[model samples]
Target chain A: MPRPAKKPRKSYHHGDLRNALLTAAREVLEERGPSFLGLREISRRVGVSAPSAYHHFPSRDAIALGLAEQGAAELATCLAAAPANPSGSLLTYGEAYIAFVRANPALYRLMFGEGFPAVSQHSAAIRALRERSYDIMKAGLEQRLPASELPIAGLFLWALVHGLGLLLVDRQIVRDGDLEDIIRRVLTLAGTGLLHGRGRDDGQSGPPPPPPGTRSA
Target chain B: MPRPAKKPRKSYHHGDLRNALLTAAREVLEERGPSFLGLREISRRVGVSAPSAYHHFPSRDAIALGLAEQGAAELATCLAAAPANPSGSLLTYGEAYIAFVRANPALYRLMFGEGFPAVSQHSAAIRALRERSYDIMKAGLEQRLPASELPIAGLFLWALVHGLGLLLVDRQIVRDGDLEDIIRRVLTLAGTGLLHGRGRDDGQSGPPPPPPGTRSA
Candidate 1:
């Protein structure tokens, strides 16, 4: 038999180098963060000429823009894939949002972080994707909340999930042993009307919490 | 009388030049954005030499870093000024956060927008200020929530306000007419735990509103 051909030296093209670049970019973003990422470094890691990487992404910001688009797509998936038995699809979308942010902290960061401003301003594809995602969110809300409440509901849920994502990604909400527990606790507080309906002192707006250095009742 | 006129433009040494440069830098950052921001521009705006701007901020990124710090300081002040009435504190914080973002969209954008990193790593003063703000949220929660839940509460509420800030600043949560109405609704939802705890189900995360194509029972 002919000598076994040595495995093709990992093909220079990486088969799908456009996607390959995104994956590599995300890795760098997550590991070293955006500040340390370099297009040449991505090319070197993929064993391609630095210029070759440009064919896939015109510039570093382009790479960042692509990643942000991916984030919107993934977020859409998260919203679509939430539990089926919920009272409102909007609620499920919100939970999925928090989950997606928690699961892919770096990618989520790219979706909203400052280094990717062009993603919001220039990319039609990315903008359309996010717009569609928000539309999905709005539709998801009609299941339980009134039509008038949709905008407010959408905003509140969006803020809670996005905020939680930032905290988890930045390590601001760390709990060594009971990580999920605290998240669930927060989720309960956010998704339910437990806090507001109860203790309604005519509910115009409840009083502020007691000031610091003051005794609790 | 003619000789007495011109005030010498208030000759500023290095120390004073620092503040002047920072103020000028922020003016440019708000007007021109990051890509167009430059030393020559800042110096021209401040009536100083291009080299003088360098004495304060070594590079454009350094100016950005300083602006971001200033933005963080402003954020702390805004959050601190929210009302202290227990029933309204949490809710008012959300509304106040929205208002600040609305009033200073570009500067707020610079504070948290892409390419701009959190000030925690760049300036000790900013970091301390940011921490103090977080403490306000944390302390507020401790007064209303169980001790075990305080940290999560702080994270959740801060995320609510900050996330709301970003969304509102970006017009993602549009504030067309009677904008305050939408804001108050969101604050109500957040304070009453509607966003975090609506359906009595915490096993799954929340959802965005359902889109046109989506069907729910």
Candidate 2:
């Protein structure tokens, strides 16, 4: 049942090395999470020398940024492809966003600057792609929400999908039933408020009951 | 401006070593993040032999779990202390939750099993603590949403806050104005639906506008 070890390639032609290294890096990112991403390990996986790998990525952080850019582009594509919701609700967009995150959990985290802090700061391409994804959500909102409400509304929807995707990917949600059902229900709530009130001034007032297992800080 | 180097502790009595090692581990976690966390590094930071540190923690993962437990407990205390909203709104709880994450960014990540995979799988106390936090959110929703709606409602609110807190902590949100005001606006949107509909049957329908710069996958 043991697999044969990979034979090292003597050399990769011009652009092939870069793609090969990135492919190996993606495998590492998925298998071990971002913490294990290293230029040395990636090059080793690609059956290349450290110097050869260095030709493509100057540092581990650079490789992470590369993955981030790749993830961002793919994510934007997925969002754009989601069937445009006709009901002015962001449900379809949310579904697409979470679907991307679920499929590429580690890559999604890396794109968001999870392990490599510099990825968020150094990559203009990544930022632009992120903005593109946001624009998809914003396009949905522009049709339904007032001009004044777009910014906060976009962020709210973004946070909702982002958080839900993470929790689902992290296995934080306790699944008692179909996950798709849970997602639809939660997204539905976002479209229709959790409470009866339609604005901030809704006069529903009462102290929240004490949480169980209260402990002193 | 250089500080004095820590001297090796000659020895420690019974329970003190555990706390001391944990304190040093926490410093490492905040300074270098979870990926940098290791038994050897922690012992070196504490100026203790590896064997001595191992007496308290079996492995690097055990130490990470210890930190997770500490973080979960602290988060629970913070949430429980948030002034209960009298108007059945969870804004106060959401604020408290985010404030804790902002204050302890790395620790918050660790508690949520960011770098350490086994921490989530192994810790019962951490799971219970997380449930307690969810219970706080659920308690707030119980006052407003019907029983059939509680599960999705609780998850929706949790995802909203969890996503919002992470976005804020990760610096994913561009700050054009007061962050506090932005958070309030977003949480307010959660209370009142983003759209005018009260349920899933709202009839507004139209093909969403094509996202800008749509790229083929």
TM-score of chain A of each: 0.76, 0.82
Q: What are the TM-scores, per candidate, against the unseen true structure?
A: 0.73, 0.84
**i-RMS values of the candidates, in order?**
6.3, 4.8
- Where in model 1 is the C-alpha error above 4 Å? A1-17, A47-60, A87-95, A135-141, A174-177, A194-217, B1-15, B34-44, B47-62, B113-123, B137-149, B175-177, B194-217
How far in Å is the alpha carbon of A185 misplaced in model 1? 1.1
Q: What is every candidate's C-alpha DockQ against the true complex, given to 2 decimals?
A: 0.26, 0.38
Fraction of true contacts retained by every candidate, in order, equals: 0.52, 0.58
Per-residue lDDT of candidate 2, residues B121-178 (tens digit): 7478988999998898778767776677787778888899889988887788886799
RMSD of each: 10.2, 9.1
lDDT tens digits, residue span A116-194, model 1: 5576463778767777777777676666676666666777777777777776776655457686666666666676643
* Superposed model 2: Cα runs more than 4 Å off: A1-15, A120-122, A194-217, B1-15, B194-217
What is residue B25's positional error in candidate 1, in angstroms? 1.8
State which docking tier applies to candidate 1.
acceptable
TM-score chain B for all models.
Answer: 0.75, 0.83
